[model samples]
Target chain A: MIPVLGGSGPVIPSFGSGSSCEQNNGWWCTDWLREHWGDTLQPALVQHIELVAIAIAAGFLIASVLAIAGFRYRLLDVPVGGFADFLYTIPSIALFQLLVPFTGLTVLTVEIALTSYTLFVLYRNMVAGLRGVPEDALEAARGMGLTRVQTFFRVELPLASPAVLAGLRIATVSTVSIATVAAFVVPKGLGEPIFIGLDQNLFKTEILAAGGLAILLALAADVALAWFARAVTPWSRA
Target chain B: MSVLADQFTAHTFVDAFRFIGDNASLMLSKTGQTCELAFAALGIALALALPLGLWLGHRHRGLFLALGVSTLGRALPIIVLIAFGLTVLGVGFWNNTAALVVLGIPPILTNAYFAVDGADRDAVEAARGMGLTERQVLLRIELPLGLPLIVAGVRISAVFVIASATIAAIAGGGGLGDIIVNQASYGLAGVIAGSLCVSAVALLTALALGLVHRAVSRSTTARA
Candidate 1:
């Protein structure tokens, strides 16, 4: 029988009747959620966070180095930018599967795919942000007898903070969403519950809960990063 | 041992190609389905979003709405949307199409709004000064000037829809994703081949749209 919400409501015990809900394939069961919160949901949330964090952190580091290098050697910019764009074009699922032969069905494969996806956004932003630093500011730093490295750190880096953080914000939120797909291979993260629910006759409660959490996490990360960007770049506010 | 390992690795690549060749009709059909799903979603999203965005932009209003819709759209995962659709809409083509439409809307809407809104205000004023009707001002001045950004939004939406369409298989919708997800039936080579096809399609879509963007921008600039 196709399970319809409230279809079996009058016959079955309501609310905390977890067994009935499970049997009838009810839309949501709060009792099942409460039971699984500790063992299932929490760990999945934690893993989701870990996956996003590691992917963004690694992506930032790599993109930063590439962006800086591309800036220093203008000749390198085209190729590096092109490469990142190429990587960005590959869909997450395809990228994940493409790596499975080399890395197997491990977290490493997932991370590699996730990290590659971030490179385009992070690299493009970093390059644009750094290049966007005002010539006057650079001149002032040079006139102050600051070394190139010192000038970059004090003047250019601060000026570029807004763009860099904007990139981070975008990358972080996107990675959060993409990392859910990672669960297909590695069986970790919020996606774990989502796929589990899908496999188990479309468990509406689990899918909704996990999917809701993923969306919330993305928005939270976006807001936090936006605030952090504004905080770091006080001059921009003025 | 090293030689044998090298041969084995080489064989896997060759095997993947052979698999694709063997399943040429199946892969092509799946790819066609993917394109159909993506385009249908894009078309619906455009029909819905463009008028709203254009009207808002013409009036120079609702900046927050445009940006908010986009940000929220990006933050919402396609997989989650599909899963949600499955619960409410049930498994099938419509569910997948609806999820993909949500995916396609934001970029196009925001871009359309911003493109028109950010058009050369002086040109808009001049058009008004020349006694062009409001419709003429919008169609001739704002839209033409904003064509590049609007097209960019379309391009972004197209790529996103195409990529996310792969997950339609999870919702009992057919696409190359069917091959990727059904690894037991399709084998490792088939899975890899499916992924390769998806990547190729995505890259090609991006490239083709990019050329269109360039051509449109160039014509717009030449006219100016």
Candidate 2:
């Protein structure tokens, strides 16, 4: 049966449940889902997750370094962040199309586009978090004769943990949802079934059902990321 | 290749500018398309959200949960919604616009909710005591007071909606996305031209929203 919070469904479990797009012949919305997507589903899900995971990892790492650079240089903040915002507005599909000539339309295009998105949200949030760090905390850390790197790791990072985590939360959830859109380019993942259903237009129930699952996936990722943030940084909590 | 790379960058800039100059009609059409979407969505959001915001902000029902939910809406990437919409609505301008509107709603809702509701309750009571109708209270009192925050939210929403609308171009609804996507097939000049046009429109829309926001807020301040 389809798992749902309400009776509403787009059963996520059966990503590759059936071939019949029409004639509820082999595909009951419930039956299609009950079949358990098995091997086909698992690899698709893994690849989707990997694409997002790598992109977010790259984004966070690059942004953290750039944030530090922004803090040090200040000028880098405006131009770099502005550029990120510009990239943020570029349609991911359009960007993917742009990259195809060079990269040949693979996971790289998806990763780059998704990763670029994380930069805008993460850069803005991380910068805000770093700026919001209590000034006196840093003063005390510096007074202890800590080197710049040591001070950043020990003082700046710890105190700024909440904002950074908030950034990560935004980044993670956005990554989860945006990752599915990568299906437009890649053949694998939860999105493929939904797109596949659309391409065939055989099963409205199938497409809607699969799509509903992706939405649920997005919501779950958002909630989990928020919880992860709370767990990582207790000081930011109520 | 190295020498050509530098020339390409400069050449792309020139070509991009020329595209804007040549295809100003297309640029304007896409810009208008985006504007229409953002403004219509903002108006719809305000109609639903303003009153609810007043209640949430003023009443003590633990609005954090609601605010948190709206934040989640914001965090959900725009493209996911687009993909989902394309599947359900089967792709077109209206479907994409509808998706953008859904994406646009939460920010305005949360902002209006917070701004209007956060008004001084004592002031609300006084207005009521002075025989103000609910309409008067909202119009003459709470709304005027909350207008700044509400407008700020709209501004924020406008910025995002404009950006999201560009991606909506992939739906082939005839916006800047048309230019950007056709870049490769259309020639290098076309690609450079399209991207610059999209960026320019996105930036200009943001700037125009900011101006309108400032003007309205200023008028409110002057009236006060």
User: Best TM-score goes to which candidate?
Assistant: 1
For model 1, how does the per-residue alpha-carbon lDDT over B1-224 read when each residue is reduced to its tens digit?
A: 00001122657667778988998899899999988998899899999999889989999999989978987887888889999999889988899999999999999999999999999999999999999999999888899888888988988788788888988888888998887777667766777788778778877887898898788778877886
The prediction achieving the highest DockQ against the true structure is: 1
Question: What is each candidate's DockQ, to 2 decimals?
Answer: 0.34, 0.25
TM-score of 2: 0.79
Instruction: Output the lDDT of residue A207, model 2.
Output: 56
Residues A1-238, candidate 2, lDDT per residue (tens digit)? 5347776755564544554535443334565555646644456666767887899899999999899889788888999998998887665655655555555557776788889989988998888878887888889988899999998888888887788887787677667766766776667566666556655543555555555555566677767777887777776772
Lowest-lDDT window of 10 residues in candidate 2 chain B? Answer: B1-10
- Tens digits of lDDT, candidate 2, B1-224: 00011123456667767877887887788667766765676566666665566666656454775576576665555655665576557667667777777777777778877777777788889999999987778777787777778777776676667666766755555666665656544455665566666566667767786788778778877886
The runs of at least 3 residues in candidate 2 whose Cα sits more than 4 Å from the true structure, single-residue gaps closed, are: A1-21, A24-28, A34-36, A139-150, B1-13, B60-65, B75-94, B114-152, B167-172, B181-192, B220-224
After the best TM-score superposition of candidate 1, give how far the Cα of residue A149 lies from its true spot, in angstroms: 1.7
